[model samples]
Target: MIDGSPLVPHIWFNQSVHFRKGSIMVLKTLQASRVLVVAYPGAADNEAYRKVIGNLEGRTVQEETCKTATQGEVLRMREKYEHSPPDLILGIGGGQVMDSAKMLRVLLENPGKSFANILEGPLAQRSIAYVAVPTTPSTGSEANGTAVIKGSDGVKVPYVTRLMVPDVAILDPSFLSTFSSDQIFTFMGDTFGHAYETMVSKLTNPLIQSIARSIIDLLKLASAELRQTPADARGLDKLMQAGYLGGLATGSVFVGVCHALAHSLEQQKGVAHSSAVLSLTPRCLSWHAETTKDPIYSHLLSEFESIGLQSRVSPDVLAGVDLLLLARQALADPAMKTSPIRMKEQEMMGLINWILKK
Candidate 1:
């Protein structure tokens, strides 16, 4: 057991595993003979990925790129490899790539089942092992069993199964250097929003709350440092750790209104997930403060201020959003059921108006 606990999965941090020799040793340990690599389009050409792939000597490796974690895309991948499934699946990139890998494992295990059917029912035990190597510091998909994939009906669908969690998660800060300053901030926004939502959710227990608070503190420190030096490896590592903790908290207690709204915006409007979270989280916090009288919001506001983030939504960030539609769509999300206070249509509209205020 790592860190004296058997509950947490094995995780390697700030490791020099991107090198050829290290990669070979890691793959050998996993006994990976036939390996399938699912990565983002840009990641296909990344030097880090290239080095790792090159080191997989004497192994049969197949590579696929996923632009989005949609049901259709996952189904296609399943069809392609139906006759001969890989012994191991490695997800290399950000949340979408990782989520694609997690979902693909399910599809491969249960052939001919629709994504909806699989989500609604219990999954068969996963046959293959998945290893997640995140290129970004957001989402922490590598550490959790939840995958949020876009559905065939153009809705964001979340699939959770203990079987979907990766067998291994690798964190390397070198990949973070690829992101620009704006991209870094957008990802940081996601991390912050996730921590906030997890902390304020009604399902939060004492253990979950402690983990959530630690995630927030780490996010605050990492983001503050990144604002000045976007390429700081130590800061990036901190962000990755915080994101991992956020993922644990989310998987443990689940998220609330902010994620519900963000998922809806991403599905309906085709907005980027991080952008949606950045635009909506502050407004969700305000709504909670007004209706629930939760002390978590005030504490979150202070943390946001400390990290140079505004405590309210920025209108410019969501200039063209249709508030009414967003509110209605968000209500359908399962996340709403766990909100600290019940959200009626009137309260939902109020949250929308709060987001729109200049």
Candidate 2:
């Protein structure tokens, strides 16, 4: 059982086993016979996934493919499987797929409740087991309990519950082979943003700080390796491990301005999460550094320089956009509450303008 003032979920990492072997071991350990496999629509026919599914020889498996993790999708999934709930809900893919599975498990456990009920507070502990198999090195949804799903209004909504944490998380480097070097760099930026935000969060404690620091170091190493050899298995493995640690750290301490701004960009402009976060990271860090004398931001900047990572937001990207509205939206985000330094709407606008200018 997870113990402490704040609970941390159990995570597992292995380099030797393939996905097929890993799935079998997890299912056997949970004594699960009926499984609900949730993944991206394209993942269902992938050869790697086919091999993994084939390992469930004697068990019953039902597959669901989702394009995005939305409230409507969660409701539909719950309605489809409510009568015959699976013993295991396995999420395989990136953050969206894993988040869909997490929310699906929430609805399954609640029986007749609507997805909106989650906004009130924490739900009861779910009895259905969940296993997260992340195909991407970003998001770290496998090791985290919070799920960011698109609301009916198209805004991103985050639901948090310790009970939603996955029962198991499997990390395999083979999955990283699918991404190009640029994609890998973007994902690494997301990982670094998570660690940086959490490290500077007001809720951060010694344990969270340690995890965040270690994650930053690992990301630096992975970034360096990927710069030279993008497909290095060992480097990708380190990236995966850093992603997991970053997830766990943020799971407890949460994020601040960077995530808040990125969520707005994602919802309003349909910017990819990693790209938005990466673009805003330098400005957010600069804002924090100006407000406080914390050495962490400076240290992160130096590390970025060492790794040859760029953190400027391009002006052409935000051309013909309403900076005022986006800044207001970001200030309203719940993530803003965790920021070590708070800002008003005007300050947020100033920050947004500064980022655009960089």
Clashes of 1: 0
TM-score of 1: 0.88
Off by over 4 Å in 1: 1-25, 119-122, 311-313
lDDT of 1 by residue, 58-131 (tens): 88999999988888888899999989999889898888889999999878988866775876555566578788
Q: Candidate 1: lDDT over CA atoms?
A: 0.75
Top-scoring candidate (TM-score): 2
Which regions of candidate 2 fall more than 4 Å away from where they truly are?
A: 1-30, 119-124, 311-317
What tens-digit string does per-residue lDDT give for candidate 2 at 122-213? 45665788888888887888887789888888877777766678878877766777788878877887888988888888788787788888
Clashing pairs in 1: none
The TM-score between candidate 2 and the true structure equals 0.90
Q: For model 1, give the 10-residue run with minimal summed lDDT.
A: 12-21
Error of 1 at 139 (Å): 1.2
**What range of 10 consecutive residues in model 2 has the weakest lDDT sum?**
12-21
Which candidate ranks first by lDDT, i.e. highest? 2
